[model samples]
Target: MTGSTNIMIRKLIRSLEKQKKPLWKTVAEKLQTPSRKRWYINLYKIEKYTKPGDIVIVPGKVLGIGNLTHEVTVVALDFSKSAKEKILKAGGKVMSLYDFDKLDLKGKNVRLMKQ
Candidate 1:
């Protein structure tokens, strides 16, 4: 937490840690690290590993390097403009980690993916 330079990301790390939930803590720990260590998932991985209607969490940015073939909800720290467009075009939802936090979607129904 002390090494993180981004205040907004730092705040997210703290807030998630304060939740006192195991999954939140794990996500907080991942978020607390430097940007270089975060995941940078692409559309292809999401498409290859997930099925329709799945909620996916990427602890870093979501790049628009590939195509999405199904509808799925994706939550991440950042997303490229094209990634957002592609997700919407594929009938999928692109959400920020903060927005995903608001939904309080339990870990059970969510699928956490990394780059």
Candidate 2:
């Protein structure tokens, strides 16, 4: 990982330890690998695999090559401008892993979306 991505992974790990969210820890582990191995989920794939109101964590960035018809919570290291806009337009929530980890959302229904 590069400096920025390394920092993000550290933050995710720290947050996982503090928040006691096992899922984030797993995602952080996945993110620590080579960049080519990291996830980069597209909106269309997420739309197909997830349902409305689901919480999703992408181990890398989110691309905007597709559209999302359902509102869902998306937590990731980065997002394309169009992806963020589309998620918001669909009444979804976009949160950074660092921010999402600070929330009192332990045990909620969350899934890791990787590509």
Q: Tens digits of per-residue lDDT for model 1 on 21-105?
A: 6767877878877778888888989889998888888888999999998999998889999899999999998888876457657
Residue 110 displacement in candidate 2 (angstroms): 1.4
Q: Which candidate is the best by lDDT?
A: 1
Error of 2 at 76 (Å): 0.4
Please report, in order, the local distance difference test score of every candidate based on alpha carbons: 0.83, 0.79
TM-score of 1: 0.89
Q: Model 2 lDDT vs. the true structure?
A: 0.79
User: Lowest-scoring 10 consecutive residues by lDDT in candidate 1?
Assistant: 100-109
Q: Per-prediction TM-score, please?
A: 0.89, 0.81
TM-score of 2: 0.81
